[model samples]
Target: MSLANLSRIARAEGDPKVLQTGRSSLPTADRVARSLGWFSIALGLTELFAPGAIARTLGLDGRKGLVRAYGAREIGAGVVSLSTERSLGLWSRVAGDALDLATLAPALGRDNPKRRAAALAFTLVAGVALIDVVAAGSATAVHARAPNRRRNYRDRSGFPQGVAAARGAAAALRAHDDLATARRLPAGSEAKAPAVG
Candidate 1:
């Protein structure tokens, strides 16, 4: 449900539907995703540096679930950031940052298995955090120069270019027909001219 998580997933697992369409994802969308990614990573890092900080920010009890979730998020972000197709480093950073924060959370107080605070977890979190940081930074850089992903026009409402062109051509034909009729008209046949004009 989290944007950071989703971005991570997308980077890891290709969304065939998105790719098949051959349209670029919007820059605004990229920006949002990238921002979320950074936020997640930063949250993790903040918790890591000072577990008390996370508790202070989210109330003391809120820090409990962060440990496991941090691991999940960092791993997720790393996968996403590593993705060759997307390489959404920014989103990865958020995920990694979240890991850093989570690992740091349990360290704030007396360690317990319930906290399940492990050095390995912290290390993994740290590794991913590094990756995410780089990724997130790269994403920011890309965003600055990132080109808008253009989508092909969908003609679902009956206004496809070909259709419109045909309609225009028909109208032109009709106008020509009217001009031919006028040319064919005899001067005395002005009486037969339609009054609609």
Candidate 2:
């Protein structure tokens, strides 16, 4: 079935039907940031569940705990990126990239057999860091309000004639209803009947 038809499965009776769909209005930076967020979560789950493998590959044999901690951090950043705070999340990923680079630096030494792997990991992270920086900046620019701008709504009102006039008209209608009810009741029955206003 088509996506529109599939969407109808969860809708209740009387709910508005989807006639069509179109492209998302999300900015390019935001779209990239969202993809990065999912990437972060996936990487985090891997690191969290297999920290030993990551540490060994990076020549950090005894630092499985630290790798696991980084995994958790990735997951948190990913969640924030996918949320309304996309810029914040992208910036966080940039910071995490710095940490990853620092952690991998020692593994690039000649003594470590996995130095080649660590170097490759560092290069990959640096590239991702560049992307994160660009996405963060773009997203921030796209969502920011104009400087020194202020909204003015003093001239607008729901009632065309003004609030006081609307209130007066409502009061008059209530009074007319009360008078008509009184006339329809038997004399001295006003106290027995419920109030109209």
Candidate 3:
């Protein structure tokens, strides 16, 4: 069976059916943010699992713990990016990229044997940082609310009748319920009845 058919099998009778599937309706910036989130998670896993390898490759000797810490940070940012708070996550990633650059700068020293690798890593991080900045700005702009916009809900009362009428109906319903409860009780239950406000 098709994917939609499979989904339909699990749905209730009155649930809306899926007619077809297509590209996501998310905005371009949001899509980018999502992609970055996945990237962050993958990279974080790598760093978390192989901090020693990463430290050796970058010539940041004895910093395995730090690399692991950064990995945790990446995973946290990734989770946020994949959630409704994409802008916040992207901004956090930009901050992380700055930290990565600072940490890698020391690895570029003349005495470091992996200076070239460090430079390459630094360049890649800088590029990703630029993308993060762009994605964050775009996402923020796309999700920002208009300052002067005001919502008009003058015609809505959330009930078929007006508010006052709805309140009166609710009181009548409550009174009816109380009467029904009284009828369901034993003869002397009124003496032990709970007080109502």
TM-score (all chains, Cα) for each model? 0.30, 0.76, 0.76
Residue lDDT tens for model 2, 1-197 = 78878888789878988677778798888899899999999999999999999998889999999999999999999999999999999999999999999989989999999999999999999999999999999999999999998999998888999988876443323333566764565545544544454
Deviation (Å) of 67 in candidate 1: 7.4
- The alpha-carbon deviation from the true structure for residue 79 of candidate 2, after best TM-score superposition, in angstroms, is 0.7
TM-score for predicted model 1 compared with the true structure: 0.30
Predictions ranked by TM-score, top down? Answer: 3, 2, 1
Per-residue lDDT of candidate 3, residues 57-176 (tens digit): 999989999999999999999999999999999999999999999999999999999999999999999999999999999999999998899899998889877787766443323332
Residue-wise lDDT of candidate 1 within 1-197, one digit each (tens)? 54545566657466432323344565543554445455555655554565654444433445645544553565455345434323564554655557456745555454443344344455656775665556556556654654797666675556556665655433323332477775665545644443332
Largest lDDT belongs to which candidate? 3
lDDT of 1 at 193: 40
Model 2: weakest 10-residue lDDT segment is 168-177
Query: How many residue pairs collide in each prediction?
Result: 17, 0, 0
RMSD of each: 14.8, 6.4, 6.1
> In model 3, where is the ten-residue run with the lowest total lDDT?
168-177
Candidate 2 Cα lDDT to native: 0.88
> What TM-score does candidate 3 get on C-alpha atoms?
0.76
